[model samples]
Target: MTRDRVPHILILGGGYVGMYTALGLQKKLRRGQARITVVDPRSYMTYQPFLPEASAGALEPRHVVVPLRRVLRKCDVITGRITSIAHGDKAVTIEPEAGEPYQLEYDILVVALGSIPRTLPIPGLADNGIGFKQVEEAIALRNHVLDRLDIAASTTDEDVRRRALTFVFVGGGFAGAEALGELENMAQYARRYYPQIGAKDMRWVLVDAADRILPEVGDEMGVYTVEELSKRGIEIRLKTFLESCVDGHVVLSKGKPFDADTIVWTAGVKANPVLADSDLPIDDRGRVSCAATMRVAGLDDAWAAGDNAAVPDLTDDDPDALCAPNAQHAVRQAKLLAKNIAATLNGGQPKEYRHKYVGSVASLGLYKGVAHVYGVKVKGFPAWFMHRTYHMSKMPTFNRKARVLVDWTMALLFRREVVTLGRMRMPREEFRRAATPKRSQRDGSN
Candidate 1:
């Protein structure tokens, strides 16, 4: 804690809140006042909004993620997973590759290890379902979807073709809806190149437990979204839940059973599992319970925010309300949290964090979208344009913004890329086959 040595601030996770908070701290704090250290499994922070476009081949996967080291030059970044937070000892245990588990002591800790995909006890989900959270998953899903199309077109077996063409998405939120819409659009355009495959032949189903989708937007916009998707032949099963997906057989609570080759699970997210290992008080949903000021309840120096923090919604009149886990609140909370932290460190009273829900926008494939922003409802091309404009404006750096814009511009001037490189997922499979001893070669009897 010596002033000359610089006070250490350890931030767990390099997601939206973690990266932005560290960036804010580095810019605001004096050079020797504190040292900001960020620990995350990945070296980059993904711009998740553009993931659907990236998966659809409209945007390159590399352009969707921002490297942490490149952006956070002022702060020390650690590429490792935090195993445990020993708050009593003022230290955290991290397990990194090629090194023993080491402890890093800190004067202050920021718990921002964002949420993970909330998977249910549903069968086959762990084995077969793909998540749309990270950049690698998005790239894998894109390749897998395109590969399935290739398999369907080349095969004459009806059952194999049916399974290959069937795609099931279990969630109606932005991630599920946007990903399915974009990929379906890509597949539709891609089918033109395959003589055996057609848009009509593909089956796309979106299942949601809630009766409505895109609850961020009002009910009216949500209804409009459902109607529009319905017109596109995307099956919408409202008030239905996925009972199980054992062995590729998907069963719904509504009594339908079908086999689908591709199942993307974007139902929702829960707090990071590491939180449970810490001494921090968590809510019933396993999120760190925090005051509106972004301070952990009853903990003097600890703070939490973003998807993993259950911050009370002061803007709402309802007593039971908590802020929705979205980028809007997360970005705002990060700024306020940083200010509050700085204020506390400087002996000033921290301010409360309060903000009203602005609005919501969703992209539905290329040149199509739906939005309800500031009481105005927009759909189709205009909404799509607004969606792009809004996310581009909010995207972290100018370099990333420019790169994304360039990707979109290139998409406008050329046809979408539909090439599938499925072997990338398991490149050794081909090598394994090549290395196998064949019967003709083993006996030299051919």
Candidate 2:
């Protein structure tokens, strides 16, 4: 592609980094200063922090995601997957939802394609384990869990009831812990509707390979989290791994084998594999290697950030330290990236990225949480409030922020939405069944 006075900026992913970068650039750059284009498989950006609560029905799923076309109105929005990036030619191949693969040329490149769930080669995990990284997955897991409760309440067999009531989550990080906590709280509230299933009948388990969970929240809060979850009757299995889960029979490395219908996997994440196909400087972990200024190493006109880029952590003593792949860093990096891009366009030098690691916050259940921020430790109701307030503030747009706040307010006034819409998964099933003829009618005995 030939360069004009105004360059065509192509952003690869519509996630935290991609969305925020485009948003900032739209506000900073004037009309025709730069033509920004963002591409991703989804039409909206999911605010991942609220996923656990969304799954638990604390927030509406639609409110947690920001529509790309709506928010980035000034920028061109492309809904598709990045098949490959040929930086040598300044071109990218994209396969859209319904069309054949096509190519686009750009003068400036922005790579923000985020990470995927780090899954293992476990036998049954691929078939049974549900991922927790997407909004669709969150809703599916919610329906599946509630359906399991329905099965438990209606079943006559004890084994089936026990299997349906047992829910196992393999990972004790923020995703797993928060999901387990919020879901357990939701399930407990749902138990009031089921006369057959008591609070003691259900089993909730969290398994992690490491000796501790919520490592980012520090030792004291981590200990407190363990104790608090234990009080909720949720078993915390530390230093243990899943040996096998073939056919829904979960066999832990240190526990008795049991059958469970629901298995949620949230271990960790690795950089997007598509980076490997790109002609970019990448690290051993398949992440784009970048300088402290968020520019791709040794390359101009190419930039990377978020979970897919290995940006140096200047605040840490370790020279090789990379900023943790979380929204806290990703959002900040995207903002800086926009400014740097603008500066470079105006013949100004780019600044290096530097930020100290801040503490983390996690919600255990309704009105229960833990946090370690700015060297201060807090837990219980205050921690829960902080967790909500902090994330709400970070949530993009006043539209979503107001919706989530209203959801929380309505929750306090009434009750949390616990009813599951299982039909969403099989919208066509009912019509198909209705259209089918009965055996007697088919046999000419109508």
Q: Which candidate is the best by TM-score?
A: 2
Q: What lDDT tens digits, residue by residue, belong to model 2 across residues 36-95? A: 999999999999999999999999999999999999999999999998999999999999
For model 2, the superposed segments whose C-alpha errors exceed 4 Å read 1-5, 439-446
lDDT per prediction?
A: 0.90, 0.93
Candidate 2's displacement at residue 14, Å, is: 0.7
Candidate number with greatest lDDT: 2
- Residue 207, candidate 2: alpha-carbon lDDT: 98
Model 1 backbone overlap count: 0
Estimate TM-scores for all models.
0.96, 0.97
Model 2 weakest lDDT span, ten residues long: 1-10
Model 1's TM-score against the true structure: 0.96
| Model 1 CA lDDT for position 40 | 95
